[model samples]
Target: MAKELDLIEEFRDLSLVCEVTPRSVKLGMLKLTNSFLEKVKECQKRDRKLSEKLVLIDEGKEDDF
Candidate 1:
C-alpha cells in the first residue's frame, strides 16, 4: 500500500511538471513570434522609404531632360 501511494505521488508530480513545461514553451514561442513580426514591420517601413526615394529620383531625371 505504501509503495502504491508513493508511486501515485510521483505520478502526480510528474503530471504537474509536464503541464508547467508546455506553458513555459508557449510563452517563449509567443515572444519569439512577436519579435519576428516587429522585424517584418521594420523591413516594410524601409521598403516604403526606398520606393519613395526611387520615385523622386525618377522625377528628377525627367526634369533634367
Candidate 2:
C-alpha cells in the first residue's frame, strides 16, 4: 500500500528510542534469528544421525570382511 511505503520513506532516516513495542525491528530480528538457529540445529541433528547410520553400515560391512 502507498501508506506503508510512505511510512518506510518517513522513517528511512530517523533513529530515536530503541526499545519500544512500536519499534518492531528488534523483535522481528530476534524471531528470524531464533527461527534460523532452530533450523540450523535441526539440520545438524539430521546430519549427525545420518552419519551415525552410515558408520553402523560401514561396521556391518567390515564384519563381513
Q: Which ten residues in a row have the lowest lDDT in candidate 1?
A: 23-32
TM-score against native, each model? 0.24, 0.24
In candidate 1, what are the lDDT values of residues 5-53, reduced to their tens digit?
A: 5665665655432222422321121222488889988887789766677
**What are the per-residue Cα lDDT tens digits for candidate 2 across 10-55?**
5543543333245343312222247888888788777976667767
Candidate 1 residues lying further than 4 Å off, grouped into runs, are 1-33, 48-65
Pairs that collide in candidate 2 are none
In angstroms, the error of model 1 at 45 is: 0.1
Candidate 2: minimum summed lDDT over ten consecutive residues — where? 23-32
CA lDDT, every model vs. true structure: 0.55, 0.56
lDDT score for residue 8 of model 1: 51
